[model samples]
Target: MITLISSDKRKFHVLEEVANQSLTIRDVIEDRRGRRRADRIILVTNINSKIPEKVIVYWLRHFLMPEEIAHASMSHKKAEKLKKWEAKFFDTDIDTLNDLILAADSLDIPSLFDGACEKVSDILKNRSAEEVGEISKIENEFTHEEEEEEIPSENAWVWRNEFA
Candidate 1:
């Protein structure tokens, strides 16, 4: 088993094949898995727990058996289940979603990047400006005078249950 050290110092045990799904891991494993004392320890020192957990779990599934997702001849029920699982995995809050996107890009996981980006976009779509700001936790930069001058009086209470 390969030892993976996530950015947050969390250690994980995974088969080399699974860990190899990460480009960074794959490069290290390719150089070491065949060596007499090939280092099995991979240190990822710029991420957090949630990202590594997500990566480790996804690679474990996709690396050794990508054919499952690529197989077009599978029974409909099995494919449907996989689809449902993927949908659920992609459904994340804005904070986790943003972190996952950054992690995916750093680790060179294209599918994960696109999947999370799509979800983030979905969350942003059809949202009011204030809702977007609130969802993303973005503080308004307007000063007191600026806020007073630019406040939309007509939609001042747009913060109500209009979207509820």
Candidate 2:
């Protein structure tokens, strides 16, 4: 068993196999092999307690089906079920999704990172430039004149939704 300590000082106990879904955790476990039992405690300083809970749940779900089976010979119904579960899991507020992306990246969980990024893209899709900026909290740094004239004039072929 491995104990993951969250940034908020919460501890999550998980089987080593389940936690191995994270390459970072797997590597840590490998490196500490034959060491004292205390070495099994991993401090996830970058992720908050809530994120660890979510991550553990994700790990447990994925752990149920081995990767070889999931990638090669899983039944169609099982695949569909897993897809639906992933869609629902990622259907969350933008801030939480962003945090999950960060945590997944830091933990080297590629599937989680990609799923969260896809959801974020879906949320941003079909939105106007201003709406996208507002949703992403990006400030418009360009002056009104620069935005309306200079940039468009410099790149005349570039598509401008607002101007269209």
Candidate 3:
């Protein structure tokens, strides 16, 4: 078992495999130095006390118990199920995604950071300026002149083509 300490000093018990998804945790394990506990005491200063709590709790609940996850060599069916479960593990709302990005970035969890950033980028892409603002929860502060300036040309919107 591994202990993960939050910015607010909350501690969570998690499995090593699950917590090692964060590169920060991996480094702690890899370090020959005496600071091995550094991995267990993660200082996610940027994330609020909520997201890490949820993520850590989820890992504990889902993967901590030995009976919860069996090795893939034992059964193909179990392995497939585990794969599917992990695939949807990070699914969340936009605000939660942003929080994940903040937490992951602060923790130096590259995979989580990349995943959250890619999700945000995908959400912003293939969307008009108004749609992007709406998804980001930004009020449409652009004046009429700004709106006019946003559209490159009337034909661009009217035509179908992928620009990059």
Cα RMSD for candidates in order? 5.8, 2.8, 5.8
Q: How close is candidate 1 to the true structure, as a TM-score?
A: 0.72
Residue 131, candidate 2: alpha-carbon lDDT = 98
For model 3, which pairs clash?
none
Cα lDDT listed for each candidate: 0.75, 0.91, 0.67
Clashes of each: 0, 0, 0
Winning model by TM-score: 2
Whole-model lDDT, candidate 2? 0.91
Which candidate, 2 or 3, would have the higher lDDT against the true structure?
A: 2
What are the per-residue Cα lDDT tens digits for candidate 3 across 1-164?
56766667776776668876666776776673455544355555545677877667544544543432454243777667755664576566789888888777766766557767887887788998778888898887667866676554644677767778
Sort the candidates on TM-score, descending order: 2, 1, 3
Candidate 1 residues 23-121, lDDT tens each?
766777677656763377767676677777887777765664475454867678877776677688877778888888887787678777888899988
- Give the local distance difference test score of model 1: 0.75
Q: Pick the candidate with the highest lDDT.
A: 2
Candidate 1: residue 62 lDDT (0-100): 63
Better of 1 and 3 by TM-score: 1
Name the weakest run of 10 consecutive residues (lDDT summed) in model 3.
65-74
